[model samples]
Target: MGLLKNLDPLLTADVLHILRSMGHGDKLLICDCNFPAAEVSTKTTTKKHVIITTSLPPVIDAICSVLPLDYFVEDRVQYMIPDAGLELPPSSVDVKNLFTAAIKKHSDTSLSGVERTSFYKESRKCFAVIQTMERRPYANLILQKGVVGPDGNDLKP
Candidate 1:
């Protein structure tokens, strides 16, 4: 009997497999609640499977267990629609805070802000996209992977 950090089979399998296939410079997109994942996937250069969760913790829990976020570059943070266009989402804070907490749980993390178009551009390069059915809008984010120390105690080790 093998013991995995995350016991959930679906989460354990999908996230683990996806992260394994990625190397440096590969992107992993963790989208906010209202990012219309199915719609935006059309433009992606990937064949990814996403797992959507209503709360931020589970999404964070699932990902952090399998992959280490890129610390060299801040996680890419982008609003759904700019202030020049539409109102902000009510749950943006929760979404933002959740991501902040998730990275803080794993490594020294910061975030980078990108315009919608720029975010979409970077997203296309992702190895996979994990969508959370969070109720908050503008919670879309992209994470890059950084190196792990030689301690042999990480997802790769």
Candidate 2:
């Protein structure tokens, strides 16, 4: 607790270290309980699968509290979409809303959709994957880290 004031308590020391160590442009994957987190994490930059015993919304809120969303990319946030091109699942929509609220102050960036297979491929390249206890289907997303200016705000071009 040493002087850290507004961050969510759910963000453990390990989680905070991971978030802090990530460089701008690195990706962080947040996935639901059903995801193959252990397997996919093996390929990530950190090769770590962090399991946080909480739901997605709070986790997103906690992560976004300190992690800036990329401004250099059109879609710094990405979610899994059904391969068949069906309507976005309810959980996915909920995740989108959560991300929207979390990043509203830092960026005007929008969330994009990646098909299931492609999403898996992208997840492998992330800095790390945080698995939440969210049971809802398609409650998975990737957040690209962005730069912070000297004054502690997002750095835009």
Candidate 3:
């Protein structure tokens, strides 16, 4: 066991596995509560659930405690469904507010959204996909792993 690493026994095996596989520049997704995180996280090399929000903010908090999601590369806009016929969840104002607050509290890090397909692709690459069990809409977020600074701090983009 190391000295400074966060230790929590309740962590799922798949989540731990995903965290183990992650390195700088890798990605991890804390998907919305409705996303199929459990099923999907099993396929990844590393993943974990921080258990932050029922909708969005808590997810951010859980993630920030361990992950420094800086150095992310995403379009500075929210990702949307491609087809007009696609269905959407009921609206909740928490999506952006919680998301922004979560990242901000962690560091100078910021968030950006990508298309649904793109976000899905990112989730696949993520070490783990954490589902929040939130009942809110548009609560999904993808995180990118960034290098720790020379002082061994998380890098912010």
Candidate 4:
């Protein structure tokens, strides 16, 4: 109730709690429709509960608006790369652009692409993963948390 009314429904109480509890450098995974989010969340070392949000873009936009992306790292945001020899789908391209624009709205960090297996492996170490109803292939992404500086800006490396 306290300030929850001001946030997006996708950013539910549990989601807000998760975000608030995360420390700097903690990673949050955004899973696509095809991703085994329940299975992955269970297997994660953190043993988090997967929060399935509305869709990829809205969830990304909502979460990115409040969470600071890790500016100290070379890559604050990372998308999963399609299998070797396979190109990213059109929807994935659009989702990537959405992520870029959302982050650019608050900070200067950009997105990087990691191999499929590496992405999944990294997901296992994340604080939590939010599964979306996005039907696009290779739409998964991970955002690392950054600290807020004295000036209320994302502290850069």
Candidate 5:
């Protein structure tokens, strides 16, 4: 059996490679089942992007375990807001809390909710989007990559 350093087996080699290749300030979109991940990812014509379809919470846990949150930015995590008149679904709330708990384990930060259109526009520029099978409305999240110090237990501010 091969042993990994920080990530687990659920985070595949391709995803790990993508995570390692990303630089500070780069963004990664962790989308829910309702998201149009394929369509949005294909819109990015400048750089090649990868789309991994998996469960949201596990992927979120794995990514947060290794990837540092951008402490320099005001909001390192961005979530999608439900359309006007549409109530925030219970699933969405659950997903938000799940992500918050995971991120809090690594950094002292909260999730920021953005307009749906704006979130979609931002998704176009992300390094990759991991589409989750989570059947939650508005559960999408965007994480900004942060730099880690030489000692590894660091988040550059």
Candidate 6:
């Protein structure tokens, strides 16, 4: 039996370590199967690809449970938009909903949209990349880490 209670089984020791090691302002990418995670991960601080055998929503939920969202940045949470325009793909909408619900109590931060190419460029700078089994198109998101104060609330401006 695992020592951590109410933690998602998918969050293994390695995954928890990655999350715990992240500092404020560090970025974490939660992406779909087609996200080129291995290639992109090579450029991240962790230099490793962490695979979670699950869909996007649960993965987002699990990560958000422990990881705080950056309140200092305007773009604390970001989703990929089709190159054509800012309209979010169906999968991205689902991602947005889950993301918003996950961090609502911790942050009032809003989500931003990054174009396909820009998203890829920004992702290369992430601290870590978590690839999920989600097959939906544009099911990708980037979360910026925030400081959790002594009282357990995220530090806000």
lDDT assessment of candidate 6:
0.85
Candidate 4 lDDT over 1-157, as tens digits, reads 5555567777877788788989999988888878988888886646676556466878888888789778778978888997678888787788778766866776676678998988999888888878888887787888999998888878875
The lDDT per prediction is 0.63, 0.86, 0.59, 0.81, 0.78, 0.85
- TM-score: model 5 vs. ground truth: 0.87
Looking at model 1, residue 80 earns an lDDT score of: 38
* Sort by lDDT, top down from the best: 2, 6, 4, 5, 1, 3
Q: Which stretches of candidate 5 lie over 4 Å from their true place?
A: 1-6, 45-54
- For candidate 2, write residues 1-157 as lDDT tens digits: 5646776787989899899999999999999999999999999999988999988878887887788878888878998888875777776677767756766644676778888989999999999999999887788899999999888977777
TM-score of 3: 0.67
Please give the range of 10 consecutive residues that has the lowest summed lDDT in model 6: 99-108
Local lDDT at 24 for model 6 = 95
lDDT of 1 by residue, 83-152 (tens): 4555555566666777667656765555666667677777776677878777666677776765555773
Report the Cα RMSD per candidate.
4.0, 2.0, 4.9, 1.9, 2.2, 1.9
Per-prediction TM-score to the true structure, in the order listed: 0.75, 0.90, 0.67, 0.89, 0.87, 0.89
Model 5, total clashes: 0
List where candidate 4 sits over 4 angstroms from the true fold: 1-6
Candidate 3 local lDDT, 1-157, one digit each (tens): 3333474332445555565567876767666667777766766665454443355566566556666444554432233233345555446454666667767776675456465666666566666666766666666766766666777777544
Specify the poorest-scoring 10-residue window by lDDT in model 1: 74-83
